[model samples]
Target: MRAVRFEGVGRIAVQELEKPAPGSGDLVVRVEASGICGTDRHILRGEFSSRPPVTLGHEFSGIVEAIGPGVTRFKVGHRVTGDPNIACGLCPSCRAGHVNLCESLEAIGVTRDGGLAEYVLVPEKQALSLPADLPPLYGAFCEPLACSIHGVDIAGLRPGMSAIVLGGGVIGMLVVQLARLAGATRTVMITRQAAKRQLAEQLGATASADPSAGDAVFDICGPGGLLSGGADVVFECAGVPDTVALAPKLARRGGAAVILGVLRPQDRVEIAPLELLLREVRLLTSFLNPFTHARAADLIATGAIDVAPLVTRQIGLEEAPGVISEPPPAGEIRAIVVP
Candidate 1:
């Protein structure tokens, strides 16, 4: 089997490795499609925390080649999406139903062999079945979409409300659709790229804005602006300091700002405490998909969320390392790796 291994910081390559077999309570999935994520680049650049000497793909889906003993839920030949995050059920957070915050977390791709190879082992608990007829490439999006679902869930969006989504990447685009489904009547997607702005509008954003053109905060939240007095909910999906700092400011008084972006570990941003205090704003952060993977799978299987537009490119497993080594191409949303 060929696998993309992250040897260490600033190092990643495709190497031939032995194929894996399912262990007890696990399933051996033949890799079909895997999506290259920003976190993969972060891992290569030492911007994100990951255990080296491991395969580096988390957002993937495949056909079940084999099943281990006691794996009764999934059978051979089933198409499934794996929830890469493995939480210790005994942990305090896990006991409290906050598995994403488990103290002992082992994520596939980040901590162990993942779906970047010809085959990867997935614990039975982490495997969620997708429709047999679902496109293989679309199944790869279930992981990221699940995470976005968790973010939208935390935002508590309501009908007839307004939402502002920062960034126009895959996460932002998916968030836009989810926000609309969550009943956000007025959804605004802010990004500098003209193409992405147009894409956002197509993906349920009521309007789009270019933050680089003018004062983004004022143009979107000022009096007589799009939302006039700011949006009821704001989502920071750019994973940058600027967007993180601007998220709360874009929220209306008594509104909520949800941070769904994944920032570098050492990065920091300054905020105005007095302003947040005066406005009584709620600043919240959503981590990994805690309990939303199933819903994400259902949404993708039923064509409830449009994911076709988000897949901008597709590459072979041989090209996976190079794609991860370099930054995404201009205006690229997602690059799927077909193994």
Candidate 2:
């Protein structure tokens, strides 16, 4: 099998490797599609902790080629997507159903071999059977969708509320849909890319704004910087110093500010503590998918999310190296690698 192995910080190579054979309690999947994530970029740059020489791809789906001993839930030819967060069921977080916080975790792509190959092995506990009608390609989206679900859940969203998502990436796009479904009457997406702005409009964004220009939403979101009012909720999905720093000024008094972006290490943002003290706003952060794989798949299978629009490119495994190092244009929303 050929796999994309992460050699170390700033190095990833497509190397011909031995195929993964199912072990005890393991399921060997012949990967059909793998979604490239922002985390993959972090893996490439060595920003995140990943075991060296590990093949890196977590968001994926494939046919079950073989199953290890005691694996009875699935058989050869079953289509599935799965929970990438392999956790110790005995851990406190796992016992509480917050397996995303599991202390002894072995995430497929991060800690072990992932799906950026012809075949990848994972624990049977992590694999979930997809609806027969669901396309295998959409399975790659489950992980990110699960994370967005967690974010929306943490926002404590309610009907007829307003939301401002500060980035137009895949996560931001998914967040917009979730917020609208949660009954947010109006949703605004802020991004520099015109294509994303337009796509957000199609996905139920009431308004799209360019961060460079002054907009009234600023009054709602940029209160301390240049206005008197802020939005009911502000989600910082663009993980940048400017964006993170600006998030506080964008939330309405008593509103919620959710940081959805992953800040690079040593990054710092200057905030107005006194203003935050007066605004009564809530500063929040959402991390990985919180054991929400089931809901994410249902959301996709039910056609609540039109993932067809987000998939801009699909390439073969041979192209994985170049695809990861130098991605397509900014207009390319999502790319799927088929092995």
Candidate 3:
């Protein structure tokens, strides 16, 4: 099997490797579609923590080729999406039902062999069933949507409330749809890309803005602005320092600012504690998906969320390394690798 391996920092390539077999309580998934994520680029640049010399794809879905002993829930030929984050059940956080914050978290593609290859191993518990008739490419979106679900949950959006989503990337785009579904009446997307802004509006954003404009933020949140007195909730999905810093400022007094973006580990941003204090804004952060993968699969299967527009490119495993090596092109969302 050919796999895209993260050799080390600044190094990644397609390497031929032996196909894997399922272990006890595991299943072997024949890679059908894997999405190239910003995290993949961060891992390649050594900005994100990962185990090198391992396959580098976490957002993927495939057909079950084989099942190991103790795996009774699924059978071969089932279409499934794998939840990459594996948490130790005995950990303190897990015991408290905070599995995503497990003391020791191991992730597929990051710390283990993942679905970037012709075959990848997935534990039965981490796999969620997808509709057999669903598009192979759509299954890859379950992972990211699950993560976005967590972000929305943290935001606590309510009916008729307004939301501001920073960055028009895949996460932002998905959040826009989820916000509308969550009953947010006014949803705005802010990004520098004109194409992504247009797409966001089509997906569900009530409006979109170019953050590069000097008065963009003020124009939307200022008195008598688009969203006068700011939004009820602000989501920072760009994973950039500027957006991180902008999140709280965009939230209305007593509203919440949820950081759904994953910035480089060493990255830091300055925030005005006094302003947040005076406004009583709740600054919160959302991590990986926890107990949300199944809901995401159901949403995708039912066509409740539009994922077809999110897929910006499709390439073979051979091209996976190159796509992750370079920054995403303008207006690009997700690039799926069809193995």
Candidate 4:
């Protein structure tokens, strides 16, 4: 099998490797499509500290090539994607239904070989059957969509509420759509890129703002500002320190602030805890999706959110190494590696 592997920090290469046979209770998937995620970039830069020689594309979908002993729910040829977060089911977090926060967790593409290969091994229990009619590319998005959904759930969005999404990349755009579908009366999107703002409007954002043009996002979204004082919810999805720093001021009194991005180490963003207490503002963080992969698949299959707009490019496995080293063009989002 041909796989894209992280040779070391600042290095990645596509090489032929032995196709893994499913371990007991495991399943082997024939890779069809694997999307590159921002985490893949961190891993390459030594921020994620993944083991070397590990295959690193996690967002994906494919066919069940084989199943291990005792695997009964699916058979060979069944179309599937999987839960990439490997958790210890008996952990305190997992027992509390917060598997995303499990102390003992290993992720596909991070801690183990992932889908950027012709065939990859996954736990059978982690495999999810895709909607028969959904395209493979769309299936590849289930992971990220699920993560976005989890954030929405944490946001506690109410019907007729106003929301401000602080980014326009794939996750940010997805959050904008989810906010709309989740019943936000006004979902305003902000980004430095004009193209991203346009895409946001097309995806149902009630308004769009250019934060780079000397326009203050916090002031515009919050009290006594452009949109006339604060939104019901403000989602920090850009993963930028500056944007995360602006979150508290963008949310209304008693509103919720949801952090959806993985901030880099040494990046500091401060919030006034005393101010939050006075305003009754809620602060929350969504790490990853837990038990929501099925719902994301349903959303995509039913045309609830169009993912085609987010897929900026698709490359072969061999091109995966270079992409990790140097990202795509500005405003280009969600590049998939077709294995």
User: On a 0 to 100 scale, what is the lDDT of residue 34 in model 3?
Assistant: 94
What lDDT would each prediction earn against the true structure? Answer: 0.92, 0.84, 0.94, 0.86
Instruction: For residues 234-300, write the lDDT of model 3, one tens digit per residue.
Output: 9999999999999999999999999999999888999989999999999999999999999999999
lDDT of 4 by residue, 199-262 (tens): 9999999888888777566557545664566888889998878888777777788898899987
Who is ahead in TM-score, 2 or 3? 3
Question: What is candidate 2's TM-score against the reference?
Answer: 0.94
Which residue segments of model 4 deviate by more than 4 Å? 216-219, 222-226
Using Cα atoms with residue i matched to residue i, what is each candidate's TM-score against the true structure?
A: 0.98, 0.94, 0.99, 0.95
lDDT against true structure, model 3? 0.94
**Clashes (candidate 2):** 4
Against the true structure, candidate 4 reaches a TM-score of 0.95
Model 3: what TM-score?
A: 0.99
Higher-lDDT candidate of 1 and 4: 1
Q: Model 1's lDDT to the true fold?
A: 0.92
Q: What 10-residue stretch in candidate 4 is worst by lDDT?
A: 218-227
Q: Put down candidate 1 lDDT per residue, 31-80, tens digits, no spaces.
A: 89999999999998988888889999999999999999899999899999
RMSD of 1: 0.9
Clashing pairs in 1: none
After superposition, candidate 3 runs with Cα above 4 Å error: none
Q: Which stretches of candidate 1 lie over 4 Å from their true place?
A: none
When superposed on Cα atoms, how far off is each prediction in RMSD? Answer: 0.9, 2.5, 0.8, 1.6
lDDT of 2: 0.84
